[model samples]
Target chain A: MNKSIFYHAGCTVCVSAEHDIVKLVGSENVTIINIGEQKSKISEAENSGVVSVPALVRPNGNVLHINFGAAISDLK
Target chain B: MNKSIFYHAGCTVCVSAEHDIVKLVGSENVTIINIGEQKSKISEAENSGVVSVPALVRPNGNVLHINFGAAISDLK
Candidate 1:
């Protein structure tokens, strides 16, 4: 499963979601990308329709906004 | 040393600074506060004259903005 979490440094929600995601999926299976560190990925995140940080890109190419209930639920 | 790092999730700079801080002071010595998770701390962070995320509050009650070169230098 190709799972990547695109996040920034100072987003509290993102950190929470990251903890949950890492717990559920195991840290080894996940790729945590700091958007600021990877400047090139900003456009890629934008292309995926992510206007905010803490977006999770699933294997199916669907992006989940971590703040949304649906996204958090989906993680479970 | 009572060192606390006030940070939010999704901030790339904070993550980098956090790594540096943990390396310098050891993770056990520093407290990483996700300002989003700890809502009450937001006001405290603001009260410390921090207008942005990733501010570090030292034991002396002085707050350091992580984006500033001086802050990073001080960490070293």
Candidate 2:
């Protein structure tokens, strides 16, 4: 299965969401891209249609905008 | 003086920061760019070295990464 792209920014909200998402999809199933530390990833995130951090790009190329206080059960 | 560029994502944190920043420099002194609503501005935000939302680009072209709970007085 293709690894889902997880665009992170290292912020508190992003960090928590990352943990939740990893648990939901398993770390091996997700590719964590820290755009905050790697500015080059900013363009990659933009290309994925991520205007903000804590975004998830599924294997099918579906983009999910995870906002603050997002519940793990709400993740798809 | 040139208008400072403010990169926003329309999130709660970004909205609060926008309010505080506009108050600090006044609306006339800052140009708000909502990358969330206007995905086209994502490139502009990336160009300004903004990996996260609530970023401020001073008139001199210095980038400020504003995180959650950032003190308004700390803005420069």
TM-score of each: 0.40, 0.44
List ranges where model 2 is wrong by over 4 Å.
A68-76, B1-76
User: What residue runs in model 1 are displaced by over 4 Å at the alpha carbon?
Assistant: A68-76, B1-76
Q: Model 1, A7-59: lDDT tens per residue?
A: 54445556665665454345875688766556666776677666665665655
Residue A56 C-alpha lDDT in model 2? 73
lDDT of 1 at B56: 53
Candidate 2 vs. true structure, TM-score: 0.44
Q: Which whole-number lDDT from 0 to 100 does residue A5 have in model 2?
A: 87
- Residue-level lDDT of model 2, residues B22-44, one tens digit each, is 65456887899877778777777
Q: Give the chain A TM-score for each candidate.
A: 0.69, 0.84
Per-model lDDT: 0.54, 0.67
Instruction: Compare the candidates by lDDT and give the number of the best one.
Output: 2
